[model samples]
Target: MSGFSSWSRRRRRAVIGGGVAIAVITGIGTYVASNDDLRPLKVDFVLGGGDDPTEYGKQLKIQGQFGGLAVAPDNTTYLFVEANDETVMWRRKPSGAIKRIQVAGMNASRATQAAVAPDGSIYLAAEDLWRVSPAGEATRVIERRGCGKANPLVATSISDFCGATVTGVTVDKAGTVYVGDQLIQTPPYGSYVHRLDGKSIELVAGRPAKDGESVRPSNPAVRKGYDPPAGTKAKDVVVPDVTRSGALAATKDGVYWNTGPGIVRINRDGTLSPFVARRSPGKISDPSGPFDTVGRALDAPVRSGTGGEPGDGLAAIPSRDEIYYSDEGTSHRPVLEGDFRWQGVESDAQKKLLDESKTGSLVHRVTDGKLAPVIAGVQAIATSKDSLYVAVTTDIKYRNTPENSATAVLRVQLPEKN
Candidate 1:
């Protein structure tokens, strides 16, 4: 069922959100960074399969490539979801130990971004929206069909029930989760922005659609209120008037996400602004510093077509003028008729087939409308406090070399003026 080719779930309906769970992680190991000369330091963010060359070499056959990542709000830890291990999520602590997090009710789908609330509550945008409890319990705040399924015996949960497709999710200091819903599958090909503020989930942006309704942005408004329909709701309500594909990250300033072609910010006042946009295709434009670029005439920054054409993964830092994100290349074609369809796809033969494919991801910093490469071969990026981290995939081990690729962590210090 894996590697046959495609982004799992696109899921959380990725292509946006990543794996999420509820709870606080324990037994996290800590490592202090060396500030000997204030130059910069790269350290192991987490320790896991990256050590076992054979492990990743084997996994690459089935896993394909790396998935989404997010840093916790505590400025202490971060989380990442692997392609092969779709259901299980890994949390990297300061101690460098990679701990396993079981996201309750999550489907074996591809994941997107993970947002950490100020209170340490983890909001992961995968499939639907999942809020991980401090006790490590995952509760589906919003449910989407194919994103997750609840056990029939687990009497307290809803199943296959979100009314829209979630692409990105970001939470504010107040713990409000704003979802970028792309009515992807539904007609109208519409997009929207939704908010789960306090008492209920409301449609902060985009026209609301009832189940089975097909309409576009130009159509007259049917309903203007944001209310969740009762009884098995994991389906499309309606698409938004925004970009259909994107990811979200939040800062005290506001929530920002990939608005189709460029990066846009949504202020606390519900205004749409542009942040980092491309001047020419794969280049960043100017004039629009980190301030509210909404309504400003900006250029479009298209995702690179080098690797798998991975869109930008965003992380909102405390700084208003800058942000950290992942810029990956969706550069390869997958092998369809291989043993990947088999159960144990890590055999030497399978590994050989996997090695034939080449792809990479990177983490970059965008500030004052400038681009700087922080880490290359980065699968996902997340930032908190004075630290920035990336998941550099080592899937190349299967290709054969004296030093095989080891999945490792890369870090960059703040004041990223580069």
Candidate 2:
């Protein structure tokens, strides 16, 4: 391999310590005590269903396979969107019951993410963008054709929702919508944090600051870190996947997101920085940026013995700055007889390996600069003031017959006394 490629590969492996194997640790007590409420909130999962069981049930349902998660500013409930093929929005009441809202041809194109403005206007992303109101009315905010993009997966087309799939969205107090585009397989292999001004989109960072002041790289903390591969400079590192867009939530100070590599927060003035910088580094499932160093935060693989897949899916409750994300294994092969799960391998290891390779999910939690595992075998996740929600998919086959697979939406809470 060339120097650059070798560097890139080494950097990727170095991000995770000790190769891909993970030693399991379970205890939310230490991590939860540092945050607000001083107690673990309640968690529950409500299942989604379709009129046709054979078509939607037993398999992944569009409504069931949730993509983006956002909490309403008022704190009454949470909102989420389906993946690319599904454009419907589902509202989860505090009771853990989900109601599907039909926007009626609301941006018929594919949707990768969604967010809500302070006023409760739902911003849904497809190849095109639409704004849905609490009253159920929908209107187009932007379209792909007019945005100067030829495809939905390019970097230059970030503004059009045509390139670098829309992975996460947020709205500021001023009503400016911040959209995170994870563009890989394209130039600038990093995420473009865009600001929606009226009907147009503009790059917020890697450019000028407010008041026409030219933004320069001056922060030693930001500049002194690891560098990308040769010729593949940091300026050109496009985020590898949606995992970089983990739960784009805005605070009075700035915006926060979870990438497969680590958690990052962009300041109100557009200074990009790390939120949680240390975790075992490796090629996490759908990781967003270049992996060059070890001890960086990484999404736990759905299973063990798996490496180099990208990670995606993140959600967080902003009021408390509590965040959650999942790292899915790129491989999907099931564990057969005599596999490690059958050996003396521990169940947690077997489960992580299977969840990454066959069926399962890995969940990570971060707050006040501390990180720890909260759950596994989750594919998608969201958060609210009162709870943490996760979607986990597992595979199943029985005696030469293909049994129906199961996808679960699990809710978890901290023990109140903690």
Candidate 3:
């Protein structure tokens, strides 16, 4: 009787344990179904040293420096271009070995941007736009005539500064390539975005200004009222503070470039309209104060000394109707000792953008009325279907300086079904 009773108790315990396991699993599944955070999608794929250098995806490691990055349609292969370096292409296999794709006589100083077509053809900007090969041949898509002397950065080599300085590029499923020209030299800065589709080139905004005939901003200096930190240099170039703004992404309706402080929609009909005007933190306007003070604030490494918050890069989550961008944190912030500054860095803008956020480099998702940060410290970013890759440029060494340390690329995986 004792033995039978003991066996019965063991059986009962097993049944209870099995029931608990089922309940736990069902609860977990329900949680995952409803919670984005709980789902495995909220994670980042950090690929670097020790992580299979090649297994993550096809990586192309360019020599001189990684200027721009683009992913192929199948989402398995990647193309990385190093601007201004003769060793232009670095291709990484699915295994771990990286191979070099050579482009003969392709010379570009500050070859700052790159993009991939739906057909897998690559386009990169140096002084001009070059059509690159998946297998390794490079040809000119557009060439600069007189603008070659100006050393233009071709966002759209189509007409060469027909709009402004091309600083950004994107493509759609139909192979339509959109280039964003930083028209800082001309007002209503960012008045136009250029589009390149096959043999045609067109502007996507207000009237196209005459080449080199736009309003330019004056140089910045330390204001009598505002004193910069010790050793801060005064700015000499007073050019407009329009940064390389906008990123290209496709939507069900059509292709779009998110530009300006607010996200503006560029329609196929050539109409430019406000898509999300008053969204989060609102568009950080050009800071107003003594121009001298602004200049003093701008006196940073990158901006040198200027009082403007130029918009940088942009990206979007199609189904979410949400767009993300890198806003120059220098909008309203005061000058700090450690912040990165160009010739015309704006002090106030930095303070404004960094008030709540810890890392000025931030990621924001567009909600109903405002833009917010999703991640910060993003220097350069690219997306492969379900993954977002961000390049965080950490340590630096000047010309001829020993490479003490280098920046790293962070991979964030977008939500995917289990």
- Candidates in descending TM-score order: 1, 3, 2
lDDT per residue (tens digit) for residues 1-418 in model 2:
1111223444332222111111111222322322222112222333332223234222223223343344554433434443344445556544444555665556333234556676888776543456788665778665444233344332333344553445456676678887665555443344556667775666653211224322222432222111221222222223333333333666666766544344566665544555554333453333222111212243222222244223244556555666655544322222212111111122352333334323334455555544444443344455554455544443334532111333334345442222
Question: Cα lDDT for residue 376, model 1?
Answer: 34
List where candidate 2 sits over 4 angstroms from the true fold.
1-43, 47-68, 73-86, 95-98, 107-112, 125-128, 145-164, 172-175, 182-190, 206-247, 258-260, 278-311, 329-360, 392-409, 416-418
Q: Model 3, 287-355: lDDT tens per residue?
A: 111110111111211211133223344555454455545544332211122111111112342222222
Highest TM-score among the candidates is held by which one? 1
**TM-score for each predicted model, relative to the true structure:** 0.59, 0.56, 0.57
Q: CA lDDT of each candidate?
A: 0.45, 0.42, 0.39
Q: Candidate 1 residues 195-289, lDDT tens each?
A: 66554565554444556664542332311111212221212223243332457777776767565445566556665555655444423222111
Q: Considering every candidate listed, which one attains the maximal lDDT?
A: 1
lDDT of 2: 0.42
The 10 consecutive residues of candidate 1 with the worst lDDT sum are 15-24
Model 3 misplaced regions, further than 4 Å: 1-64, 77-84, 92-98, 108-113, 125-127, 144-164, 182-191, 208-241, 244-246, 276-311, 319-321, 330-360, 367-370, 398-407, 415-418
CA shift at 25, candidate 2, in angstroms?
Answer: 27
